[model samples]
Target: MHLSIFKWSYIVTAVSLVVAFLYGGPSALFLCVILGILEISLSFDNAVINATILQRMSDFWQKIFLTVGIVIAVFGMRLVLPLVIVWLAAGLNPIAAFDLAMNPPADGAAYFPDGRASYETLLTDAHPIIAAFGGMFLLMLFLSWVFEEREHTWLSALERPLAKAGKLDAMAVLVSMIVLLVVSETLAEDAETVLFSGVVGIVLYLAVNGLGTLFEAGQEDDETTADTAVDKALAGANGTDTTDNPTADPSAVQSKARSGGPTQLVRATGKAGFFLFLYLEVLDASFSFDGVIGAFAITSDPIIIALGLGLIGAMFVRSLTVFLVRKGTLAEYVYLEHGAHWAIGALAAILMVSIGVHVNEIITGLLGVAFIGAAFLSSVRRNKALRARGEDPATVGAASH
Candidate 1:
């Protein structure tokens, strides 16, 4: 199973890196590759969601997602960001920003006309950056809570009246925009741009999801065909070919012998694989958000920024993904998803507060680490208790459905 998983991951990584490197230079290509891997790892749970929803998509659409979605993400988020950041960063002109991004002072000192590092100075820019990340993550928390509650049939009191309304994700995006607008008016430190950037972040998520949805449609159609075929095959008289040979490749005969285990395994694998991919990407983006702004405390070369952070970050994310999937770590950590949701929420809050309070990226990272770590510890304790009582985890109390 791990061998198969590794094979597939290799394919995904290889494909993503090739694309990234081809579009951008070594720096960009490396950045994309690193980010892709990072995103894929952190969002394994996201992959679970993706697989479930992707069942609705067409194969063509899925291809579009693999191809087009990556394009938008790499260029829109990474390449174009410097220019945009420069424009939004105070009175710094595009050239000045590019200059700051590309060429630092020869003396490793502040080189701007004001004797302060213009672009160099921005390496430590926390407010605008954190605001975007924290704001979006907070929005994620709100959406998760609202959606989770909407599904609770036994608790009418806990259910929202808005549950009867339109999509919660869409609503969250709108609300985020409004919040940005309000926060912008109050927080004069690049408030308008931060609001604008927040809108961009939301749009990027939606666009990625929209593409994912399209792929899901393709999958839905295939699933329908497969189901129809299975029904017809099952109903056919003396047609036992599909069920024969548990370990053998039954290509020559209509055998009757079959193992139920393999079928269950296939279903489980498919289900797990889908969600794992989605969760990895979502988490990847989350991690990147935490890293990007945080990178400001370092150098400002978009090239170096992408390279330094991307390489180390990407490797770590991939390793983590492999560990979780291969090691069946999710089975061990019941509250991982919960922690992710909370982390997303905390990051969003930190991003929002960054506008006024200048929340540090270290603080943001620590919050995520702390929330997830706490949830993990809680899950372990709860699981240990369940084991002591000999209760079935499947049937026992787990927060998630």
Candidate 2:
């Protein structure tokens, strides 16, 4: 390992262990590290998107993001969230699950009977809901990618028809929910439970987005005027051709196009960062459900759950976000964001599916990883092709050579 790597690893490990010890003991500490690695691997794509946004925030907001954000992720999502779903779905009391997670011995004996996290009992009971949620998320992801082809003229034409009927978005959400309720309810009752939880999450996402957009302060930039008189004078000496009208300057087209689009894209993407952050977090949660449930396939200790999974795994995602930004991968890899968006859409569908069927977490995760991996590899190949041909890498952005 690099010397810097060793130092950061040691520090993070030491800090995590200390936190684990305060919560439970050595078992929790060990589990925290294991879960941390698992979460980081499953979530690197999330980090890339987060990095893209976080890099733009002021340091004060960045600090808030790392500190307060982690607490919300840990206590709010990891620790309490699963239990809340149990209450909302199975009619189990909220505090009952929390008390069970806290009172390890009591919950282990009475609720689980098999000596596991009571939350897992809730989830296993609600498998259909999880399957539906995951399935829907995966489906959404696939559709997003399918429609993203820039050169596909047919799709652009199809968009109008699809939009007119609201056939895509409404149909997707409605069909998935209907299937989860009608079919999964008959086959697996707990699946309905998971579906309810996912719907709640989607509602939350819509609300957050609405609020963010409402708060947005719009601004306009003054358009740049080209020095056409100076351009005409210089071009006259160089025997450059222009349109008969002096202002119809063909010579300046390249520079004007280059300047205009980038400024607009940067501004649009900057505004987009917050919404993207919300999407990424929601997407990460969808992916985490499988891992969280699967961990019960291993052990059920809440301390181990928090330490092994929460501290080590979830915490590291934050660090990974930092590393992605610091390394400047977004600037280097043009398609990384596209890959992430597609993966997110996939994960969302899979999450919806998990509510209704027994979609394996490993398969769901690999599907997302595969999508992103393909995009990244494609970006690399395109970059290498340009390099080999002695063309500027910047041409990747141009519509034509």
Candidate 3:
């Protein structure tokens, strides 16, 4: 609805057209446009998840996400990541990999002089590892969220059981590991690669998430200490026992926390924000694995892939993120975040299974859209039901003033 949110996307599309035209020709430009659209289609859910996280972040960090983060998303993940993958997989130096990307062999021809393998071929061959890693990482993210104990749930029947199961520490990680093992055994070849990559994904999630939790806990402890000291000082000045004052109103305390308390409670700052940024970048990379690989199907030209999918796609995704945050879409929809995570879970499963069996990209995109759409409709129904019951939808679960 906000045309301004899409302003950058429009500018990026125009720039991509010119660049694509100059780089190759009309055909190249057309491919660029198509790839850009594909990226957007494939990544809408990603934008939603990003908004869920971005809403928690401070405005300063949010700006950084849109600006510096866009650079990393577009150039770092889209361009450099592919090069790194090819370089590592093919044992080619970075320069050679870049050259191969720029000048890939004819459709079926091998690029290596010794007839070893083409860059595209090698990249394709690495799919199992890529899929396993990305799948596991995404799966872990979704599981952690779904299993978290919450007062309200979109899918109460299912989520309630999951929340109960979540009482066991590291339940999400344990389940993810079991799934990874099962998936690894199904791979015909490079099972080790799949297993190892999956382990790396799990470890990466634990490490990043653990760091965040540690810092958050530390911040909370510090705040509690400060608040306690202030309370004692006030009690001394008033010549009254601290306990004599009735306990502060819980709702008021919560309101204070929400408004004046450390915004760091939800969005990290300082060292924590840095790591949160890293986590986001890694998550984006995982989401992009399919898009990067799928781009090869559209065109073997890596430059075109980067221009359309990388640059243009990144812009639109960022725009969508800002739109969601500004409009308070997540809070309004209520179940939308739940649906996004469920979609993420499904995507993760599909990615892992695709290691042994190919899955259509269209199916992947549709699955996400379906989950999100269903959740949106469910939210609308819930809102109407609440209104019918003489309750304001906006006040649902909100702390009273």
- Model 3 clash pairs? none
Q: Give the number of the best model, judged by lDDT.
A: 3
Lowest summed-lDDT stretch of 10 residues in model 2?
217-226
Those runs of model 3 whose alpha carbons end farther than 4 Å from true positions after fitting are 1-4, 107-116, 226-266, 397-401
Q: Write the per-residue lDDT of candidate 2 for residues 1-401, one digit (tens) a residue.
A: 23432344456567878887777676666667667667767776677667766775545555555676767666666667677766765677887776765655553443555655456566566555555555455444334344444421122345334444454554545544564455445544564455565466545545654544443323123211234444454454355744434455455545655555323432223444455445545555655666777777556766566655665666677777766666777666666666776666666655554444566667766876886787677667667887888876544551121
Put down candidate 1 lDDT per residue, 88-193, tens digits, no spaces. 6556776666766676766556565567655655644634664574466447544544455432221233334545443444666666677777777777477656
Per residue, candidate 3 scores C-alpha lDDT tens digits across 1-401 of 68888887898889988999999999999999999999888787898999977776667878888889989988888888888888888789878888877776665575556666776787888888899999999999999998898756887878888999999999999999999888888763777888999999999988997786677667667777756655554454455644634454545545554565543344556666666677888999999998888788788788888898888988898899889989988887788888899999999999999999998888998999898899888888877888888997766862211
Error of 1 at 374 (Å): 1.3
RMSD of each: 8.7, 7.9, 4.7
Model 2: runs farther than 4 Å from truth? 1-10, 18-27, 55-59, 90-95, 102-117, 127-202, 210-281, 398-401
Q: The CA-based lDDT of model 1 is what?
A: 0.52
lDDT of each: 0.52, 0.58, 0.83
Q: What TM-score would candidate 3 get against the native? A: 0.88
